[model samples]
Target chain A: MDTAVLAGEIMQRSGAETYRVEDTMSHIMRKSHATRIETSAFTTMLLVSLQEEGRQPLTVVRRVHKRGMNLDRIVHVNEISRKLCGDSLSLEEAYAELKAIEQESQKLYRPITYQAATLLTVIGFAVFFGGTWLDIIGGGIVGAVLVGINLLGKKLRFNNVFQDISASIGIALMGIILKQYVFWNMNLETVIISGIMPLVPGIAITNAVRDTLMGDYLSGAARILEAFMQAAAVAVGIGVGIVIASALIGEKVLL
Target chain B: MILKIIGVFIAIVAYSVIIETPRRFLWLSGLVSAVGGAVFVVCNEAWRMDMVLASFWSALGIALLSHIFARAFRAPVTLFLVAGILPTVPGAGMYRTVYYLILGDASMSSFYLTQTLEVAGVIALAIFLMDSVSRIFLKRDVGTQPWTKERNMDKKQEEK
Candidate 1:
C-alpha cells in the first residue's frame, strides 16, 4: 500500500493524468495480495485503499501541492510499476526506484544546454512561420534574452505569470531594438511569436482535452482553467511588451 | 514544406526537453509532432480547410500515433501525445485574441476567441473518440480470457 501511494504521488505531482495515476496505483496494490483496491486521484491529491482478506483496510492519502510537467518521471514510474506488477521487482526495490525518480525530477538541466534548446525552439518557430534569415537571427537573439530572463526568474522564484510577462516584454523590446538598429527589415511579429512559443500552454490545453474526454470532469475543468490562465499571462506579457516598445520607439507598430 | 516539417521536428524535440521527456522517446515524440504539423499544413493550406477542422484532423492523427507508440514502447500515451499535439494547439489564436483585445477591436478579439475555443473543442472530441475506441478493443481482447472475466467479477463484487 505504501509503495502504491508513493507511485501515485510521484505520478500526480509530475502532472500525469488522474486516471493514469489511479490505474498505476491500483495495479501496484494488486501485487500485494490485496482483495480489494480502491484508488481515487485528483489534480491536487491522491487517495488509495487496499483491503486484504479479514484484516483491516490500509489507506493512504497524499497531498500534492506543486505540480509540474516532467514526463520523464512519469515514464520512469510507469516502467517501475509495470515491472513490479510483473513480479520482476521486489517491494523495496520499487520504493527505491520511486525515490530515485523523485530526486531525478528535481534536478535542473544544464544552463547552457537549456539556453541552446530555447534558442533552437524560437528559431524553429520563426522559420516554421515563414520568417526570413534575418527573422531567424533576430528571433535567436530575442530567444537568448528570454532565456536569460527565465534563468533569473527561476533563481528569484518569481510567480509564473510575472515570469512570462517579463520575459515577453524583454523579447518584444529586443525585437524592436534589432529592427531599428541591427536589421532594418526584421519582422518583429515573427520574432515575438517565436519567442513566446515556450511560454504557451500547449501541454495544458492537450491534457485538459484528454481529461475531459476521459470523464474526469473535475480535473478536466481545473486543467482548462489552468490553460486559460497561462494563455492570459502570455498575452498580457506580449501586450505589455508591444506597448512599451511602441512608446520607446515613438512609432505605431500595431498598425 | 520540408522546412516546416524539419522545424516542427526541432521545435518538438526542444519542447520535449523542456518537459523532461525520457531520452529514449524524445525522437519518437518529435517525429510524431512533425507528422501532425505536416498534416495540418496540408489540410489548412493545400486543401483550404477551415482552421478548426484542420486542427481537429491534425490532433486526431497525433492521438492515433500516440496510442500506437504507447503500445509499442510499453509507455503511457501522454508521453507522445502532449508534445506531439503542440503544433496544432491554438497558441497563435490565443495571442491574436489578446492582441486584438488590447487594440480595442472587440470584433476581432471575439473572432479569435471563438476560433480558439472551437479548435480546443474539436481536439477534445478527437482524443475522446480515440480513447473510447481503444478501450473497446482492449476490452474485447481481454474478454476472451477466462481469468480476466473472473477478475472483473471479483472487482464488481468488491465494489458492491
Candidate 2:
C-alpha cells in the first residue's frame, strides 16, 4: 500500500495522465495479495485502497502540488512499475527505487546548458517560421530575456500563471526593442512568436486530450481550462507590453 | 522546406531537454517531431491546404509514430507524443485570437477563436483515432509477450 501511493505520487507530480497513475497504483496494490484494490486519480490528488479478506482496509490519499514536465522521472517510474509487475523486482527493491526517484536531487542539465537550450529552441522556431538571419538572432536574444525572467521568477517564487505572463511580457518587450533599435528590419512576429513558443500550453492541451480519451473527464476539463487560461495570460501580457512600449516610444508601433 | 524541417527537429530536441526527457529518447522525440513537421509543411506549403487541415494531418502522423515508438521502446507514449506534437499545437491561432480581440476587432477575434477551436478539435480527433487503433494492436502484443503472460494467467485464475 505504501509503495503504491509513493509510486502514484511521483507519477502524478511528474505530470502523468490520471488514468496511468490510477492503473499503476492499483496494479502495485494487487501484487500484495489483496482481494480488492481501488485507485482514483485526479489532476491534483490520488486515492488508493486495498482490502484483504481478514485484515482492515488500507487507504492512502496524496495531494500533489508543483506539477512540472519531467518525462525522465515518468519513464523511470514506469520502468520500475513494469519490472515490479513482471516479477523481476522484489517489493523492497521497487520501494527503494521509487523513493530514489521521488527524492532525486541531481540536476539533469547544468544551468548554462538549460539557458543555451532555451536560446537554441527559440532560434530554431524562428527558422522554422521562415525567419531570416536577423530574426533568428533577435529570437535568440528574446529567448535569453525569457530565460532570465524565468530564473528571476523562480527566485521570487512566482506562481505558474504569473511566471508565464512575465515571460511573455519580457518576450514582447525584447522583440520590440530588437526590431526598433538593434535590428532595424527584423521581423517582430518571428521573434515574438518563437520566443513565446516555450510558454505555450501545447503539452497541457495534448495531455488534456489524452486524459479525456482515457475517460477521466474531471482532470481533462481542468487541464483544458488550465491551458486556455495560460494562453490568455500570455496574450494579455503581450498586449500590455505592446501598449507600454508604444506609450514610452511616442508612437503606436504595433497593432 | 528541408531547412524548416531541420529547424523543427532542433527545436523539438531542445524543448525535450527543457522538459527533462531522458537522454536516451531525445533523438527519437526529435525524429518524430521532424516527421510531423514535414507533413505539415508539405500539406500547407506545397498543397496550400488550410491550416486546420494541415495541423490535423501533422498531429495524426505524430500520434501514429509516437505509438509505434512507444511500443518499440517500451516507454510511455506521452514521452514521445507531448513534445513531438508541439509544432502543430495551435499556439499561433490562440495568440492571434487574443491579439485581434485586444485590437477591438471583435469580428477577426471571433474568426480566429473559432479557427483555434477547430484546430484543437482536429488535433484531439487525430490523437483519439490513433490511440484507439493502437490499443487494439497493443492488446494483442501484450497478451503474447512472455512477461505479461504470467500476469494474464493470474488474472484468469482470479476470474475463475
Candidate 3:
C-alpha cells in the first residue's frame, strides 16, 4: 500500500534491481500513496516521464539503472538478492513491469474494443492490396467483425480460452474470404503471415530463450511451452482453413 | 558484400528496436545478424566449407553474440535472438519454396522442407541456446516493477 510495499511488488514482478525499485517507490511516494494510481494518473506520470526524458528508448533507461551497482536503497537486499534482482531487470523484465501495471487494480482504456474491429477491417484490405471499391468495402467489413468480437470479449469478460477460440475462428472466417472471394489470386502466404502477425511467437520465444540462458530453467521452460502453444494456435487457425479449402477443391491446401 | 551484411543486421536491429526491444543489445543483435549472414555466405563461397558447417558456424556466432549481449544489457536473450535471427529468415529460400510449390515439382519438396526448416532452426537455435546459456549468467536488476518486499512475500505464500 505504501511506497516500500509497492516497490516490493514491482521488484517481484519486474525483477528490477533493488535500487530501481527504491527509485520508483521514492518517486511514487513523493507523488501518491493510494496503493494504485488511476489509469489516467499513471498515464499522466508516464507522459511526464517520457516528455522530460525526451523520448529515449525505454530499454536504454533500464540499462542505465541496471549498471548502478551502488543502487540498493533497502536492507535485506544482500548480494544474492541484488544479483537476482539484477537478473530479473533485463529487457525481458519489461513484461514484469507490465504485469505490475496490470495488477494495479486500475487499468487503462477499456481495451479500445471498437478500435480493434476497425483495425482488423483496415488490415484485411492491406492484406489484399486493394485498389478496387469492393476490396476496400470487404476489408472494412472484416475489420468491423473482428473488432466486434474483441468488444464482445471485453463485454462478456471472456476468459483466455474463449478469446483464443473466437480469435482463431475469426481468423478462419477471414481465410474463407481469402479463398472464396479472392480464390486463385488471394496471396495466401501473405494473408496468413499478416493476419497472424499478432500471434507471432517472437517475444514469447525470445523471453523463454533468455530465461533459460539466465539459468531460470523452470521459468524458461514454462515460457517456451507457452510460446509454442501460442504459435500452434496460430498455425491451427490457418491450417483449418487450408484443410477446408483442400477438402472443397480435392487438392492439398498448400497455403 | 560487407554493406549487405551490415544492412541485414541493421534491418533486424531496427525491427527489434521499433518493436520496443532493450537498447542495450540493439546494436549487438544488429551486428550479429549482419555478421552471421556474411560469415555463412563467405564461408560457404570462399572457404568451400560444407554448407551445413558454414551455417552451423554462423548460427553459433550469432548465438554467442546474442548471449553476450544479453549479459551486457542486463536484459533477456530475445532482443539479441530476434535481432540475430531475423536476418537469416531465408527470404530467398522461401521464394524458392513458393516457386516450387507453384511449379508442382515433388522433388523440390525436400528443398522446401530443408530450407524452411533451416530458417526456423536458425531462429530456434539462437533462442534455445541463448536461453540455455543465459541462465548461467543471468542478471536481475529491473528498473521499474512491482517489487515491494511485502508484495513478493505475499506472492510466495500464494504460490506455495
Candidate 4:
C-alpha cells in the first residue's frame, strides 16, 4: 500500500497524466491480491484504496502540489511499475526505488546548463523563424537577459506567473533597445517571440487536450485554465513592457 | 529550409534538457522534432499550404513518431510528445492575439484568436487520431480499465 501510494505521488508530482497515475497505482495494488482496488487521480489529488476480504481497507489520499515537468521521473516510475506488475521487482525494492526518485527530485542538470539551454533555445527558434544575423544576435542578448532574470527570480522565489511576466517584460524591453540602437533592421517580432518560447505553456496545453480526450475532465479543465493563465500573464507583461519602453523612447514601436 | 530544420532540431533538444528528459533519449527526441519541422516547412513553404493545415500535418507526424518511439524504446509517449510538439505550438499567434487586443484592434485580435484556437484544436485532433490508430494496431486495450477475472486467470495459467 505504501509503495503504491509513493509511486503515485512521485508520478503525479512529476506531471504524469491523471489516467496514467491511476493506472499505475491500480496495477501496483493488484500485486497484493487486493480484491477491490480503486485509484483515482485528479490534477491536485491522488487517492488509492484497496479492500480485500479482510476486516479493514487501506486508503491513501495524498494532496499533490508543486507539479513540474520531469519526464525522466515519469519514465523511471513507469518502468518500475511495469517491473512490479511483471513480478520481477519485489514490493520493498519498488518502494525503495520510488523513495530514491522522490529524494533525488532536485537532481536537475547544472544551473549553467539550464542557462545555456535557455540561450540556445532562443537563438535556435529565432533562426528557425527566419531571422537574419542581426535578429539572431539581438535574440541571443535578449535570451541572456531572460536567463539572468530567471536566475534572479529563482533566488527571490517569485511565483510562476510573476516570473513569466518579468521575463517577458525584460524581453520586450531588450528587443526595443536592440531595435532602437543596436540592430536597426532586426525584426522585433521574431526576436521577442523566440525569446518567449521558453516561457510558453506548450506542454501544459498539449497535456490538457490529451487529458480531456482521455475523459479526465477535471484535470483537463484545470490544466487548460492553467495554460490560459500563463499565456495571459506573458501577454500582459509584453504589453506593459512595450508600453513602458516605447513611452521612454518617445514613439509607438510596438503594440 | 535546411537552416530552419537544423534550428528547430537544436531548439527541441535544448527544450528536452530544460524539461529534464532522460539524457540518453535526447537525440531521438530531437530527430522526431526535426522530422516534424521538415514536414511543416515543406507544407508551408514549398507546397504553400495554409498555416493551420501545415500545423495539423506537422503535429500528426510528431504524434505518430512519438507513439512509435514509445513502443520502440519502452518509454512513455509524453517524453517525445512534450518536446517534439514545440515547433507547431502557435506561440506567435497567441502573442499576436493579445498584442492586437492591447492596441484596441479588436478585429485583428479576434482574427488571431480564432487562428490560435484553430491551431490548438487541430493539434489536438492530430494527437487523438494518432492515439486511436496506435491503439487499434496494438495488443489489447492500453487504457485505464480495471483488471478482469479473465486477465487474472490468464496470468495464473501462464504461471502454471
DockQ of each: 0.53, 0.63, 0.09, 0.64
Q: What are the chain B TM-scores of all models?
A: 0.86, 0.89, 0.69, 0.88
lDDT of 2 by residue, B1-160 (tens): 9999999999999999998998999999999999999999999999999999999999999999998888788888999999999898777776677667666889998998899889988988999999888877776664323236446747865796
The parts of candidate 4 lying over 4 Å away from their true place are: A105-108, B140-154, B157-160
Q: For residues A1-255, what per-residue lDDT tens digits would candidate 4 score against the true structure?
A: 898889888888888888888878877887777778898999999988889886599888899988888999998998898888768999999999999998984666887888899899999999899999998899899999999999999999999999999999999899989898888898988999999898888888788977887899999999999888888888888888888887899666763
Q: Interface RMSD (C-alpha) of each candidate?
A: 2.7, 2.1, 11.0, 1.9
Best by DockQ: 4
1 or 4, greater by DockQ: 4
C-alpha displacement of A61 in model 1, angstroms?
2.1
In order of appearance, the predictions have TM-scores of: 0.91, 0.95, 0.45, 0.95
Candidate 2 collision pairs: none
Give all candidates' CA lDDT scores: 0.82, 0.86, 0.46, 0.87
Measured against the true chain A, the candidates' chain A TM-scores are 0.94, 0.98, 0.49, 0.97
Across residues A1-255, which tens digit of lDDT does each residue of candidate 1 receive?
A: 878888999899888988788878877777677777899998988888888899988888788998888898888887788777657999999999888777763444665777788888888888877788999899889989988999999999998789888887788778877887899888777777888888888888878877887779999999999988888788888778778877887756665
Ranking by TM-score, best first? Answer: 2, 4, 1, 3
| Candidate 1: stretches off by over 4 Å | A52-56, A105-109, B137-160
Clashes of each: 0, 0, 44, 0
Error of 1 at A202 (Å): 1.3
**Which pairs clash in model 1?**
none
Q: Candidate 3 DockQ score?
A: 0.09
* Worst window of 10 by summed lDDT in candidate 2 chain B: B141-150
